[model samples]
Target: MGVTGIGGLFFRADDPEALKAWYAQYLGVAPDGWTPWEQQAGPTIFEPFARSSDYFPAERQHMINFRVTGLDAMLERFRTAGIEVVTKAEWDSPEIGRFARIHDPEGNPIELWEPA
Candidate 1:
């Protein structure tokens, strides 16, 4: 057989429950421990950022990028839910579409990208 799409993204969380709730509430991501969210069907982009990349400016070491649809609507949802969404002018490119940043309860940086 051939390789399939991404199955899951796992990471350490100081409070898994709270973190899961944050994702589910603000990002509309389902909470399934160790199980991948069956993301809405669409195009996906996967790439690694260089260590020197300033895309995510947290003191931590890693960031996760979530490919998403309806970027504007989602950003509004996060704001209505009292979550702060960060945007940068440089992060937007004519070829790459728009991007917004948010953090989980445990301070994990999440990049939400809407593809071009």
Candidate 2:
């Protein structure tokens, strides 16, 4: 059979355990290899941005995007938890979705998409 979906993401972190815990507590991801996170049926975008693109930080080579349901409420919770969330009006559209940006402790960029 052909590829079904994304299996897992492997990346380097300063403190793997701490990063894993951060994702687990903040983003509610199961970083443990034994427990796989379930995702709904939806579209998965796999476009590559230009090298000089300013969509995210230039120092970082890659960024991860996560699809969300309630953008406003989730952002509010993130704010209450003292996590910084960046949103721009231009990043939202009636056809596409709302978006917010956040960086990990190591300055890796992450984009949150609440699709329309």
Candidate 3:
């Protein structure tokens, strides 16, 4: 019984309330004072990126990857909500999954993955 799953993800937000609301609206994540959200049981990836990796913005220290289902539907929703979603054909793999990228209002990179 060493380290378990992540307890939470805490980050500095210039406008915490606005960011929370954005997440709630676009990603369906509950905001402050709301019930804690639980993810369905699944594989969670925990890998470190190289300091010079071009996979994401170099200025940011970390990028958050979230497991998702119905990625096409979600992307459509994000587009309808005016959220810019970035995707590349090369990023998808039959062995792994499909991927899409988007930045939060705070400019943090968030990766959405739909396992194959």
Candidate 4:
């Protein structure tokens, strides 16, 4: 049988409740007792990068890339919610698509990618 796509993304949170509420309020992702995100059907990129790859430039070591539909809308939402969203023109690629960066409460890099 062929392998399926990613089932879930689990990570550690200092305060799970607060983190969940933050995500729910901003990104529409509600962590209901560690439930997996109910994402829309679209391309789910699954690839491994070199350990020293500088593709995602961040002070932190690990970065989580999330697929989104409406980048502008999401960016605006984050801005209105008093969240900082960083976008770089150089990060945009004709092949990889548009990308924006944000940080979680614990300062984890989160890449918001809208595939072409």
Candidate 1, residues 39-112, lDDT tens digits: the string is 67767666677777876774777788888889999889888877789998889999988999988877788889
Clashes of 1: 0
Candidate 1 Cα errors over 4 Å, as ranges: 34-36, 41-43
Top-scoring candidate (lDDT): 3
**Per-model TM-score on C-alpha atoms:** 0.79, 0.92, 0.92, 0.79
Each model's lDDT = 0.80, 0.88, 0.89, 0.80
For every candidate in turn, the CA RMSD to the true structure comes to 2.3, 1.3, 1.4, 2.4
Candidate 3 residue 35 Cα shift, in angstroms, is 3.6
List residue ranges in candidate 4 displaced over 4 A. Answer: 34-36, 57-61
Candidate 2: tens digits of C-alpha lDDT, residues 61-98: 89989998888998998899888999999999999999
Instruction: Flag regions of model 3 displaced more than 4 Å.
Output: 32-34
Clashes of each: 0, 0, 0, 0
Give me the displacement of residue 11 in model 2, in angstroms: 0.5
